[model samples]
Target: MIQALVIDDQEINCILVKGLLENFFPDRIRPYATSNLAEALELITTLQPELLFLDISMPEMDGFELLQHVRKQQKAEVIFVTAHDAFALDAFDHQAIGYITKPIVSEKFVRTVSRAIELIHQKTNTGLVETLKKAIITSGNNQDKRITLTSQKGLTFVDPAHILYCESSGNYTTFFLVNREQIVVSKQIGSFVSKLESHSIIRVHDRYLVNLQHVTSYIRGNGGLLVLINGKEVPVSVRRKNDLLHFFDE
Candidate 1:
């Protein structure tokens, strides 16, 4: 049986998380629930569970403080369950498996739990984990300058300038970088449209978002295609051709 622990200051929240996990997650989650930080710390020491559900804010001791203490003594992947959306980016900084926003919607809860399970099964690579920890800590100073992507493994730091293009395939979105590296995310393409648009990345087609800075040439005819600096040809819908040209003229 896989061990799981839920730490929340509110008794009801702790119980609710525990119940949700038991129902949505497979029977593998053998849950241990606690509201007291002292008791929770003791349980972490004793149980050393493989997974943890943490709340960021608590009386006397907060979630980040608890995480710091527990991480030093044990290695458990955490999925933060908090009422505040502000901590979501902070959660990625700590290489958390996932973040659940306030009021606890069941569908969102299940989605986060599903991602956590993927992390458990994938066995996060050490190099990538280290990269993420460093990226997260350093990211606070560069929030306005850089964008970070959080996934099952960890966080990836991306410079909008180095991005070549983004491609969508169903639920997955792939980021192609200037260094020839690709960061494949499990989120939908539209999810990233807003975050990247301001950086000069524009949607060329439903399946493609190309960085305007990386467009080397445009191959015309048959709806045409964009040749990126990296040599990848991203399609352009004929209807969007005028918009693409208008963007260039701006």
Candidate 2:
């Protein structure tokens, strides 16, 4: 069975999360719910659950505080559930397995939990450092200046300037770089789009994130295709064609 813990000051939220876990995993999951951070910390140390569902807003000890404490004690999978969208970026910065918004939909909740489970299994089998590096590299923006990538070998810090573009393959994202190296990370194109918005990278298609710096020319074909420095052609979405042209013009 997969042991889980729910930490929320509000009883309703705790119950809601517990119910979802029970429904999703049935007999394979056991959950411990608590309102107090102190009690939660104790349970976390002793129980060492495979997953933790946490709330960002709480009296005395906030979600970030609890996360820091957990990091100090042990490395357990964490998914933060919060009402405030403002905390989403911060939650990602802390390497949270997932950041779920309030009034969680059953589908999204189950998906997030499943993702956490997969990540936990991967970390347990491979190692934590490798997983963390891959997450940082895939989630970083070119303007971020730095990123991290992980593998069975070890973690590698990457300079975003070296990245050429990112492509999505099924459930994975592959990063193409200037030096002819590629880094495959476990993330969707949409997630990378949001994180790399401030950088030179733009979503040219549903499956491609192109770096404006590497774009040499755009061929106006049936829809459109962007030609990169390495002679690779990437499709441009019809909806974003005009916007891409305007961005280049500016």
Give the alpha-carbon lDDT of every model: 0.84, 0.83
What are the TM-scores, per candidate, against the unseen true structure?
Answer: 0.50, 0.52
The weakest ten consecutive residues by lDDT in model 2 span 143-152
Model 1 ranges off by over 4 Å:
124-250
**Minimal lDDT window, size 10, model 1:** 121-130
lDDT of 2 by residue, 1-250 (tens): 7789999999899999998888888865798898887889899999988888999999978999988988897777889998988998899898898989998988898888887776765566456655655665688845235665553335456666677899998878888999998888776778777667677888988899998888899999765999999999999989989989899889
Best by lDDT: 1
- Top TM-score prediction, candidate number: 2
